[model samples]
Structure formats: structure tokens, C-alpha cells
Target chain A: DAGVTQSPTHLIKTRGQHVTLRCSPISGHKSVSWYQQVLGQGPQFIFQYYEKEERGRGNFPDRFSARQFPNYSSELNVNALLLGDSALYLCASSQGRTQYFGPGTRLLVL
Target chain B: GQQVMQIPQYQHVQEGEDFTTYCNSSTTLSNIQWYKQRPGGHPVFLIQLVKSGEVKKQKRLTFQFGEAKKNSSLHITATQTTDVGTYFCAGHGDNNDMRFGAGTRLTVKP
Candidate 1:
């Protein structure tokens, strides 16, 4: 079975612009979570959705938001992007407690 | 909010040497997970510990969870060049909110 998959392997955006990244969870998975990873740092949790419901949220700002679809796919959106927002966005899918990550979408903001 | 801290920030060891990384959380965790991320690549889940004082081993790697569920450790024995990468520890709290440590980057000298 294929692992978690993400779209737009890379992206470039300008300050004040908005961007959206997509993720498709593994088959039979009902939980999707979003994380942002800065250079030389580990990933920071953004949002987690289980069974299409917002189960948890992290310390991210209002500019970041995410949602899960019925099919367990997820989308992460960043508004009014800043240079600090440049990082790799990762999506993970979980069945119980163990999570599988995607290749991630590298976002560069100028 | 939960905080996970890892150290030492980086490690460099000769081939066949042993290496270890520690992770501590500000709050007790429901579970702790280990992941490895290669340079310019996404994270891959290694293992998860749900019970306190749990110990699991995979090949040359051993993972341990503290009795309090507030700390964890990952150790590699007789490391190889292929072990070069960042190791991250992620913790999940009672609400299922996850937090990741800054990661310990390992450089193996062949």
C-alpha cells in the first residue's frame, strides 16, 4: 500500500501572499495532521484532524489553518505569508498512535 | 502547551562508534515516538512507546521511555554511515496534541 502523499513538492510565495498545500492520507487512515519544519529544526505541530473533526491544534498563529475531508485528505493554508513562514510543510496520517509522514511541500517565502 | 527538548544538538562519531540522544518533555506524555529524517528528506517513523518504562530495539538501535513518561532516549550501537540523519522525538499529551523536539543531528564519519 502506498504511504501518505502530499502535493506540490515545492512552492515559492511572496510576503503577504497566500498558499495552500495538500495531503492525501494512506488508505484506511482517518487522521491527518500538519506540521511545519524549519531548517535545522524539527517539525512543529500545526493542526490535527481525526475523522474529519478538529481534534487538536498547536501554537501556530491564526494565519495557519487546516482541515480534513471525508476521504481523510487534508489541506493546510497560510495567509499573509512572511519570510519566517518559509519552511517545509509535512502531512502525516495515523491509524491509532503511530504516524506515517509524507515527502512534504517545501515553501519559500520572499 | 507541551515542550519537548532534545540534546546534544548534534553528534559526530566515527563508524562503529555508539551514539545516543535524549529527549525530555515539560509535561507527561501519553506516548512517545521516534523518527529519522535524512538530509533534504521527510521524517520516517521508527517506533512508538505507549507504556511507561518501555524499551524496544530494532537492529542496532534501542529506544527507551522513562517511567514518568516525560522523557525518552534513542541509542545506536556500532553506527554506520547510513545512520547519518536527524533523530526526532515526538510526544503526545492527554488531548492527543503532539509536540516535537528540536532533533539531534547525527553525522557518521566513514
Candidate 2:
């Protein structure tokens, strides 16, 4: 089966702008999670959705929000983006403990 | 707050040498997972260990979950240039929340 997929492989935005990143889970997967990875750092969890409900959230600010669709696709939105938001936004899908990650959306905030 | 930490933030070894990275949790974990991310790439799942004192192997890679469920380790019998990447360990808490460590960056010289 195909792996998790993400959209807008690359994006550039200015501070204060808002941006949305999308993700499509692997076949038959029902949970999707979002993470942010700054250069040279490990991925930090952002949010997790299962069955279209918010299952978990990380230490990220309220400006970071996410939702899952009925089909298991997900979207991550960052409002009032700051230069600190420049990083690779990763999406993962899982059935239980094992998660598969997508290629990630690279965002650059200037 | 839950925290996961990895040791030897960086390692450089010759292709034929052995390498090992460790992950420790501030509290007992329900489960832990390992991932690898090559430079300029997103994370990819390597394995998940849900049972204490469990040891799993894949090729030359061996993963071990501590008997106390508070620590884990990944050891490569013989390093290869292709093994160069950042290795991360993620812990899952009671709420199914995931926390990732800082990761150990590996550099192999062939």
C-alpha cells in the first residue's frame, strides 16, 4: 500500500501570515498525527486525531490547530506564523503503536 | 510532563565499527518506538517495543526495551555509510500521547 502523503512539499510565508498543511493517511489507517521538526532536531508532536475526533495535543500553542476528516485525511493550520515556525511539518498515521510518516511539508517563515 | 532523552547527541564511526544509541524516559512508558531520518528527509518508523525486556532484531540492528520499561537502546552491529542519520526514540504515555527525544545524529565514514 502507499505510504502517508502530504501536500505542498514546500512553502514560504512571511511572519504573521497563516498557512495550512494537508496529510492523507495510509490505507486503512484511522489515526493521524502532526509533528514539527526544526533543523537538526527530532520531531515534536503537535496534534493527533482519530476517527475525526481530537485524541491528543502536544505543547504547541493555540495558534496551532488540526482536524481529521471522515476519510482519515488531516489538515494542520498555523495562525500568526512566526519565524520560529519555520520547520518541516510531518504527518503520521497509525493503527496502534506503530506509526508511518509522510515526506513532510517544508515551511519557511521569513 | 513526560520527557524522553537520548544520549550521545552525535556519533561518528567508521563503517565497520559498532554504534549504539540510548533513550531514557522520565517515567515508565506504555510503549516506545524508534525512527530514523536521513538528512533532508522526514522520519521513518524503524520499530516499536511494547513489552519490557523485549529484544527485536532486523538485519544488523538490534533494539532492546529495558526490563523497567523506562529505557531502550538501538545497537548496530556493524555501521555502514547508509546508516548515517538521526535516530529518535518516542515514548507513549497513558493518554496515548507521544513524546520524542532529541535524537542521536550518526555519521559513518566509509
Candidate 3:
């Protein structure tokens, strides 16, 4: 089966611009979560969605938001991007406990 | 808020040496998951421990959950160059959200 997939492998944005990252969960998965991974650091949770509803959110600022679709795909939106937002955005899908992560969307704010 | 902390930010050992990383949570965890992220790669699930005092082994790696369910450890026996990467311990909190530690980066010298 195909694993979690993400779009726009790389992105370049400017400060104060808005960006959106997409994620397609694996088949048969209903839960999708977003995380941000900075260089030399572990991933930090951003948001989690299930059944098209918001389930959990991390300590990120209000500028970050996410939603899941009926098909279990997800999109993470960040507004007013900052240089600090330059990192890998990962999407993970899970049914129970184990989560499988996507290759991630690399975002750079210039 | 729940937080997970890892010790020994980095380790460098000979290819045949053993290495271990520790994870501690400020609150009891519903479950703990381990992941390995290669350089410039997304995190890949390694294993999950759900029960207190549980132990699981995968080839040269052994995982142990503390009796209190608030700490965990991952030990690699006879480390190989292939084991080089960041080892992250994610503690499940808030039902659907997982908090990841800063991670322990392992470097093996041939």
C-alpha cells in the first residue's frame, strides 16, 4: 500500500506571505496530523484531524491551522510566514497508535 | 501541558560499541513511540510501547518502558554505521497528540 504522500516537495515564500501544505494519507487511514521539524531538532506537533473535524492542536501560534477532508487528506495553512517557519512540514496518518509519516514539504521563507 | 525530554543530545561511538538514549515524560503517557529519522529524511516509525514495564526488541535494538510509564529507553547493541541518525521518542498525550523529544543524534565511527 502507498504510504502517506505530500505535495510540493519544496516551496519558497516571503515573510508576511501565506503558505499551504498538502498531505494525502494512506488508504484506509482516517486520522491525519501535521508536524514541523526544524533543522537539528525533532518534529513539533501542529494539528491533528479526524473525520473532517479538528481533534487536537499543538502550541503553535494562531497563524497555523489545519483541516482534514472526507477522504482523510489534510492541508496545513500558515499565515504571515516568518523566517522561523522555514522547516520541513510533515504529515502523518494513523489508525490506532502507529503513525506513518510522509516525505514532508520543505518550506523556506526568504 | 505534557512534555517529553531526552538525554545525551548526541553520541558518537565506534561501529561495534553500544549506545542508549533515554526519554522521560512529565506526565504519565498513554503510549510511547520510537522513530528514526535519517539525515534530510522524515521520521519513520520504529516501534511503540503501550504497557508499563514492557520490553521489546528489534534486531540489535531493545526498547524498554519504565514501570511508572513515565520514562523509556532505547538501546542499540553493537551499533553499525547504518544506525546513524536521530532517535526520537514520542510520548502520546491529549488522546491523539504525540509530543516528541528533542531526539538523540547517533554517529557511528567506522
Best by DockQ: 1
The candidate, 1 or 3, that scores higher on lDDT is 3
lDDT of 2 at A109: 99
Clashing pairs in 1: none
Candidate 3 segments whose C-alpha is farther than 4 A from its true place: none
Off by over 4 Å in 1: none
- Model 2, span A1-110: residue lDDT tens: 89999999999999999999999999999999999999988899899999999999888999999999999999999999999999999999999878999999999999
Each candidate's DockQ score against the native complex?
Answer: 0.84, 0.82, 0.81
- The alpha-carbon lDDT assigned to residue A53 of candidate 1 equals 92
lDDT value, residue A95 of candidate 2 = 90
Each prediction's TM-score versus the true structure = 0.97, 0.98, 0.98
lDDT of 2 by residue, B41-85 (tens): 888899999998999999999999999999999999889999999
Tell me the tens digit of each residue's lDDT in model 1 across B1-110. Answer: 67899999999999999999999999988889999999999999999998999999999999999999999999999999999999999998655677889999999999
Q: What is the i-RMS of every prediction?
A: 1.0, 1.0, 1.2
Better of 2 and 3 by lDDT: 3
Lowest summed lDDT over 10 consecutive residues: which window, candidate 3 chain B? B91-100
